[model samples]
Target: MDELLRLDGNAAAGVLGEVFSFEATTAEYACGGCGRAGTLGGAVVYEVREMGVIVRCPGCDNALIRLAHNRNRHVVDLRGTTSFTTG
Candidate 1:
């Protein structure tokens, strides 16, 4: 159960890159909830099955991003993040 819930960000890189136009899994993220910063590759990824993917801050365990796809639309919610930048 736990194994299915936790995976490295690399697992979702392809899907994330498609939405960001860049390699998002290698990007850096600052958590709005804790102000802690970490690379997306270091973050934990939670797969919501066919729904989408959830990325959490490795330092604070706060959700940093949520990505979902519906039909031809890609939905991305970043309320959990204060800032994101690529290295």
Candidate 2:
């Protein structure tokens, strides 16, 4: 008998795509109060615009004045978790 092992990068990437759908531009800012790098966590959502996606920090709940526009090829639509399998 032989054991079967499976690995799929595409599938993993697809899952990741659904999670992180937004793209960040070259503009990076640190929190003036907390001095924390990178964006905040929690249910952080944004709208895509010509200038950029208007985002807010989940940590401080501060509205980002401006963010450059960038492209994220890994955007995926994950409305439901029906595709996922659980044991």
Candidate 3:
């Protein structure tokens, strides 16, 4: 993804706040695909539809996180990453 189109993870803090009790953008993620590790603030994020977001690895473009709200329900997927941790 183009650098200019990428929004800082903080920009999604409002939406992420709804799902995580702690601050999510500050969480660390280890990419399973490329062995890249960093805070979510440095990941590549794709805003999907009107109610969803996808977080990808900045190094390998692997889809590491997925979040969606639909039909009054919230869905979160993190299968692509090796680990997602907050400390």
Best by TM-score: 1
Q: Give lDDT: candidate 1, residue 4.
A: 48
lDDT of 2 by residue, 1-87 (tens): 123212221222323334444422222445443444452222133534333333344456444332333375333332211122211
* Clashing pairs in model 2, backbone N/Cα/C closer than 3 A: none
Best lDDT among the predictions, by candidate number: 1
True-vs-predicted CA distance for residue 4, candidate 3, Å: 13
Weakest ten-residue segment in model 2 by summed lDDT: 78-87
The all-Cα superposition gives candidate 3 an RMSD in Å to the true structure of 3.1
How do the candidates rank by lDDT, highest first?
A: 1, 3, 2
| Candidate 2 positional error at 21, Å | 18
User: Where in model 1 is the C-alpha error above 4 Å?
Assistant: 1-4
- Pairs of colliding residues, candidate 3: none
Over the stretch 1-87, how does candidate 1's per-residue lDDT look in tens digits? 643467898888888988888888778888998999888988899987767889998877888999988997889999999999987
lDDT digits (tens) for residues 14-86 of candidate 3: 7788889988889998998999989888887777656688888878889888888998877999998898899
Ranking by TM-score: 1, 3, 2
**Model 2 misplaced regions, further than 4 Å:** 1-28, 39-43, 48-52, 65-87
